[model samples]
Target chain A: MAHAHESNTKRIWIVFGILSVVTIVEVILGIIKPESLMASVLGMKILNWIFIILTIVKAYYIAWSFMHLEGERGSFKWSIVLPLLILIPYLAFILLVEGNYIYDVYSESFVSWDF
Target chain B: MEATVNTQTEEENVWGGGNQPLGASYGKMMMWFFIVSDALTFSGFLVAYGFSRYKFIDSWPIADEVFTHFPFLHGVEAPMYYVALMTFILIFSSVTMVLAVDAGHQMKQKKVAWYMLFTIIGGLVFVGSQAWEWATFIRGDYGAVELRSGRILQFVDAQTGKRIALDEFAQPIEDERVVHLERNGVWYQSGEGLPSYTVNEIKAGFMANENVVGRAEKLNEDGEKIMLSREETAERLESAVHVVEGANLVRNEYGNRLFADFFFFITGFHGFHVFSGVVINVIIFFNVILGTYDRRKNYEMVEKVGLYWHFVDLVWVFVFTFFYLV
Candidate 1:
C-alpha cells in the first residue's frame, strides 16, 4: 500500500506532464491548419489526419494513465486495452467510409429520389 | 485472500472459479468491467456521430455556433469557454481526489476530509454549469423553419451565409390572429400563444414584409445560405412565435434536434454521475467526520470512491474532446 501511494504520486505528475504536452500539440495543429497537407491524401484531407492522430493520442493516455493499465500485468493490460484498440479502429474505418458514402448520397443523389 | 479463494475451490464458486489475478477486490473488478462497457458505449455514440457528420460533411452544423455560451455574457459570441471551464473543474477535482486517497493511506482523516470536501464542491459546480448549458440549448438562440418533412431551413442574408432570425424578416404578430384578449394566457386556454415563436408564423409574417426569403438548411458553394440569408432569416424571426411545425427537429438556431438531444443525454448522464459522486462524497465526508473509517483503521472506502471520481474525470476528458475541441 505504501509503495502504491508513493508510486501514484510520481505517476500522477508524469501523466499530467504528458497530458499537457499532448494538449499543446493539439492546439498547435489546430491553429496552423496548413493547407498543403490538407490539399490531398488518397483523396482524404490532411485535416482528417491531424484529427485522427490527436484523438488516438488522447485515447492512449486515457487507457494507459487514467486506467492505470501501465501498472497492471502485461497479459491483463493487453486483454483489456488491445481488444478495444482492435475493435475501435475497425469501427472507425467502417463508419468513416460508410459515412462518406452516405454523404455522397444525401448531397448528390438524395434529391433524385421521389417521395 | 488467495489461499482462501483457492481453498474454496471451483465446486463452491460459479464466479471466476474463485480465482482472480491482480488482487483487485470484487467491487473494483466489477467497476473495471462496467467502465469498459461504458467506454465502448460512448465510443459507439461518438462514432455514430462521426458517421452522420461524414454523411453530411459539407452541410452539417458547425459545433462552434451550436455551443456558444458563457456566464453572464449574453450574445457575446464566446464559444466553448463554458465547457472548457467545466473540464478544468473536473480535472482539478480528480487531483483533489487523488490527494484524498493519498491522505487516506497515511491515516490522516482530517486531510482526507478536507480534500474530499473540495472534490464534492467541484462536482456540484460541474452539475450547475451543465444545467445552465442545457437551459441555453433548450431555449435556443436563433429560431428556424420546421419543414413538413422534419428537416430544418434557417434564414440567412441573401449575400452572406450567416444565419438570419425569423424576427428580422418577419412582421409583428397579427392582432387578428391573436385568439387571446389579455397580456397572459389567463381566463380561457385560448392561449396568448407559444412563449417562443415558430417559423410558420414567421412565414405568414414574411408574406407581409418585403425582401425576406426562406432558405433551406443547405448552404451554397460559398458556404453561404443556399436560399435565405441574414436579412430574410432575421425578418422571419422578428415576428414569429413557437417553432416551424415539423421543422422543430432541425432548429435553425440550434442546428439539428438530434444534436441537442444527444447533448442533453450525454452531458446529462455525465452530470448525473458527477452529482451522484458528490452525494457519495458527502456521505463519506460524514462518515469521515464521525470517525467510521478512522476507527476501522483503513480508508479503503475513500480510496474506492476516489477511483470512481477519477473515472468520472477521465470520461469527461473524452467528452470534452469530442463534444467541444473536435
Candidate 2:
C-alpha cells in the first residue's frame, strides 16, 4: 500500500495535459460548429456526438488517474464504475425517447402552439 | 448460544469482519458507495433535463446564443470561451488534488498542505465563476416578449441577422400609468416591477422599424431560430402579453421556462457541491498544517478528499458537455 518510494508526478502531469488538450479541442469544435458535422446523423448532430465522446474520455481519464482507480484492484474499479456504466445510459435513453414521443404529440395536436 | 463461537474459516466467511472486500479499506468502500448513490442522483437530474429539452427540442434556446458573455469582453460574441476556461480551472484543480494525495502517500506534509491549498483555491474560483454565470443568466441581455401562451419572441435585424435589444428601438410613451405597489392595489398581493417597455411600445417599435423582425422560439432546418415574415410578425406581436427581461422560476427570456429551471437546478446543485468540497478542503488543509496526519503517519484523509474533488470535476465534464457543448 506504501507508494512513498515511487514517483507518479510524471504520469499526473501527462494526464493533465491530455485532459486540457481534449477540452480545448471540444471548445474549438463547439465554436466553429462545422456545417458538415452539424447535420443530423441519427437524430443528433454528429458534432454533438463528438463532444459527448470527448467528455466521456475526459471523465474516464479523471477517474482512472486522478481518482487512482487505475491503481486499484480490478474488482474494486469495476464495482465503482460498472453500475453507472449500465444505468446512466439506460436512464438517458428512456427519458429522451419518451420525451421525443411527447414532443411529437404536441406538434401534431390541434393546440396551435404558434410554431 | 454456545457463546457464538465462529464455525467458518476466514476464506469461507464472506461476511467476516476481518476481511477487506475488493481490497478497499472500510472508509474507501463507504466513500465509493456514497459516490455511486450521488452519481445516480446527478444522473436523474441530467436525464430529467434531457427529457424537458427533448420535449421542447424545436423551441429550445440555442445555448451558444445564451452563454456568450465572458468576464472582460463586453460585446464580443465569444461562445463557450468562459465555460471552457472554467472547465480548465476545474480539471487543473483536480490535478492539484491528486498531487496532494501523492504527496500524502510520500508523507510529505508540507507539499500536501500546499497542493491542498491550491485545490481549495481552485474550487473557490470555480464556485465563484458559477455564481457569476447564474447572475448573468438571470439578468438576461436583449429582452424578449412573452406571449399569452408562455412563448418568448425575440427580435433580430432583418438585414444583418443579428439580435437587437428592445431598448434600441422602443419609443417611450407618456401615459398616466401608475405602478401598483404593495400599499396601493390588493394589499396582500404586490405587483411585479414594471418592465422596461410595455408590449404596446414594443409593437409600435416593431411596426416603425422595417429593419427588425420577430424570431420565434422554434428552429428551422438550418438550426436557426425561425424568423417570422412581416405579416406573421405583426400577428405574433398581437399576442404579446408581457415583457420578459431575464430568467426566473416563472419565466425565461430565453425560449423555454424549462430551460431556466433545469439550468438553475442542475448547475446550482453542482455549485453547492463544489462549495462544500471547498469547505471540506479547507478543513483538511488546516489539519495538514496542524500535523495531525503527520503524527498518524498516514494522509488517507487527503486521499479521501481528493477522491471527492475528482468526482466533482468528473460531474462538471458531463455538465459542460450536455449543457453547453451539445
Candidate 3:
C-alpha cells in the first residue's frame, strides 16, 4: 500500500495489451462464428459458452487491474466478490428456468398466437 | 483515573472504535460497498433481459443483422465492426484512467493531467458513439410490418438473402388522410403520427415484386430468421395491421419489442452513468489543471474518480458481450 512512488506505467500498458488482444479475439470469433462451435454442447451453443467465458475473463482483468483489486487485502476482495459470486448465478438459473417453463406453457396452449 | 483506565481497556479490544475494517479507509470501503450494490442492480436487469429473451428465444432478433451499419460505410454489411470499435475506445479509456491514477500516485501532476485529458476525450467519444447508435436504431434502415398478433414481419430479397427497405418496394398512396395533430384530432386524446406508407401499399408492393419475400420473427435451427415462401408471404401479408418503420415503445422493426425495451432501458441507464462520469471527469480535469490536488499533498481524489471511471468501463464490458456479441 505504501509503494506510492513506484512507476506503474509498465504494468498498465501490459494489461492494456492483454485487454485489447482479448477484445480482438472476441470480435473475430463473433464475426466468423465457426460451424463447429455453433453446435450445442449442453443446453446452449459452444460458441455462446466461449463468449460468456471470455467476457468473464475480461471482467476479471478489468476488476483486478483497473480497479486495483489486486492491491487490496484478502478479506476486502472476498467481501466484494463473494456476494455477487453467489447471487448472480442463482438469479440467472431461476430466471432462465422459469422463462423456459413459461415458453413451454405458451407453446402448448390452444390459442394460436400467430395467424 | 478510573474512567481513563476503562477507556484504555476498551481501546485494546478487537472491536475498537477507531480502527478501519479490513485495513481500508472509510471512503474506500464505502465505495466498495456502493460498487457491490450497483453490480447487483446491473445483474438483476441483465438477468431479467435474459429471462425475457429465453421466453421468446425462437422469435428474438439476431443482433448481428440488426446492428450492421457503420458510420461512413453506407449500405455496407459490416456486422459488429462499429460496436467492436466502440468497445475498444472504452477499454482504452479505462487504461488511460488507471494510468492517471498511477501518475497521481507518483505525484506527477503533469502526467496525471495529460492522462486525465485522454480519459475524458475517450469517454466523450464513447458517449457520442452511443448517441449515434441510438439514432441509427431509431431511424431504421429498412422497415417492416407488424402483424395482428403483435409480431413484426420484415422484407428480404429471396435471391440475395438481403433485406429490402420499405421505401424501395412500397408504392405511395394518393389518399386524402392528413396527419392528425393534438389540437385537431380530439379534445384530450391525441392521435399518433401515421407511418409514411399504409399496409395496403406495402401489400401491393410485395405482390408486385417477384423477388421480395416476407421473413418472420422466428429463428430456425441455424439461428437465422425464417423466411416464408412467395405463397406464404402473400398469405402473411393479409394479417399486417400496422406498418412499423422504426423502434418505439410498442413496436419495433426488429423482431422483439422487449429487445428494444431492454436495449433502451439498460443502455440508457448505462449511458446516463457514462454521461455523469464524463461530467465528473471534466471537473476533475480542471481541478488537476489548477493544481488543487498538488496543494493538498496527495492525489487520492484522482484515484477515487479513477475507480468510478473503471467501474463504468467494467459495466460496459458485460453490456458489450450480452447485448452485441452473445
Candidate 4:
C-alpha cells in the first residue's frame, strides 16, 4: 500500500497510448468492414464481436489504470467488479434470447403486423 | 475504567469496525459504490436498447449509413470519423484529469488547476459535439415516407443506387394545408405541423421520376436494405400515409422508431452526466485555486472527482461501440 505513493506518470501515458491505438484500430475496422469478417460467428457478425472485445479491452485499461483499481487491494477490487461482471451479462443474455424469440413469433405467426 | 476503554479499542480494531478498513477514505469508497450503482443503471438502459434492436433485428437502422456527417464537411460521406474524434477528445480529457490527480499527489496546485481547466474545456467540446449530432439526426439527410404499417420507405436513384432528397423529386402542389391547433379545430386536439410535402405531391413526383425507386427497411441475406423492383415500388407507393423528413420520438426517417428512442435516451443521459461532471469539476477547480485541499493537507477531493470523470469516459467507450460501431 505504501508503494502506491510512487509517481505513476509513465504508466498513465502508456495506458493513454494503448487507449488511443485501440480506438484508431476500431475506427479503421469499422470503416472498411471487410467482407471476410462479416460471417456470423455465434449469432453475431465477427466484426461486431471484434468491436465488443476491443471495447472491453479499452474499458479494462480505463478502470485499471485511470481509476487506479490496480493499486487497490485484491478483495476491494473484486468487491467492486464482481457484481457488475455477474449481473450485466446475465441480463443481456436473457433479454437478447427473449428478443430473438419475439422476432420468431413476429415472423412465423399467422397474424399480420405490417398491414 | 481502563479495562473498558481497552476493550472498546480492541473491538474497533483496524480490520474490524475501523472506518478506513481498505485504507480508503469514506468519501472515496462511497464514490466507488455510487459508480457501481450508476454503471448498472446505464447498462440496464443499454440492455433494453439491445433487446429492442434484436426484436426488430432485420429492420434495425445501419449505424454507418446514419451517422455520416462531419463538422464542416458538407455533402461528404464520412462515417465514424467525427465520433472517433469525439472519443479522442474525451480520452484526452481523461488523460488531463488523471494528470491533475497526479499533480495533486505531489501537491502541485497550479498544475492541478491548469489540468482541471483543460478537462473542463474538453468536456464542453464533447457535449457540443453531441448536440450537433442530435441536430443532424433530427434534420435527416434524405426524406423518407412512412407507410400505413408504420414502416419507412426511402427514395434511391436506381441508376446510381444513391439516395435522393425529397426536394429534388417532389413537385410543389397548391392546396389548403393547415396545421391542426386546439384553438382552430373543433376537436380540442392538437398535433404536429404538416410536413413540407404531402403524400399526393410525393406520389405525383415519384411517378414522374423514371430513375427513382423505393427501398424497404427489411434487410436481405447479405445485410443490405431490400430494394423494391419498379412494379413493387409503384405498388408500395399506394400505401404511403405520411412524408417523414427527420427523426422524432414518435417517428423517424430512420428505419426503426425504437432506434431513435434509444439513441436519444442513452446519449441524452450520458450528456447529462458530462454536464454535471463539468459543474462538479468547476467547483473543485475553484476550491483548488483557493488552496482548500492544501489547507486540509490532502488532495483526495481531486482524486475522488477524477474517479467520476474517468467513469464518464468509461461509459462513453461502451456507448460509442454499441451505438455507432456495432
DockQ of each: 0.40, 0.77, 0.85, 0.82
Report the lDDT of model 1 for residue B71.
Answer: 86
In CAPRI terms, model 3 is classed as high
The reply for model 1, stretches above 4 Å from the true place, is A1-4, A7-11, A17-45, A107-115, B1-20, B159-161, B176-201, B204-215, B219-252
Model 3 Cα lDDT, one tens digit per residue, B1-326: 74465556667875856655466777778878888898899999999999999899888999998899999999899999998999999999999999999899888899999999999999999999999999999888899998888989999999998899999899777873678666775667556668889999998898889999999988998999988999998888888999998787778999888999999989988998899999999999999999999998888888888888888988998999999998
Compare candidates 2 and 4 on lDDT and give the better one. 4
Quality class of the docking in candidate 1, CAPRI style: acceptable
Local distance difference test, per candidate?
0.67, 0.89, 0.89, 0.92
Which of the predicted structures, 3 or 4, would earn the higher lDDT when compared with the native?
Answer: 4
Go through the candidates in order and give the clash count of each. 36, 0, 0, 0
RMSD of 2: 4.1
lDDT, residue B147, model 1: 47
Candidate 2 lDDT tens digits, B201-265: 89889888999898989999777898888888888888899899989988989889889999999
User: What digit string (tens of lDDT, one per residue) describes model 4 on residues B1-326?
Assistant: 74465556766785566544455778998999999999999999999999999999989999999999998999999999999999999999999999999998888899999999999999999999999999999999898999999999999999888889998999888864867766776786656658889999899899999998999999989878988887888888899998998899989998888989999999999999999999999999999999999898778999999999999999999999999999
Per-residue C-alpha lDDT of model 1 across residues B1-326, encoded as one tens digit per residue: 74565556644664755455544556666666676777677778778877776776566666666787788998787776677678767767877787787788788899999989998999888889888887777666666655444456565554554556666665555543434555765576644345345445566666665555566546565334457544655553454434642222234354455666567667777788788889999999899989999999888788677767877787777677667655
Ranking by DockQ: 3, 4, 2, 1
lDDT over C-alpha atoms for residue B171 of model 1: 58
> In model 3, what are the clashing residue pairs, if there are any?
none
What ranges in model 4 sit over 4 Å off?
Answer: A1-4, B1-18, B178-189
After superposition, candidate 2 runs with Cα above 4 Å error? A2-5, B1-16, B176-189
Model 4 DockQ reads: 0.82
Model 1's alpha-carbon lDDT is: 0.67
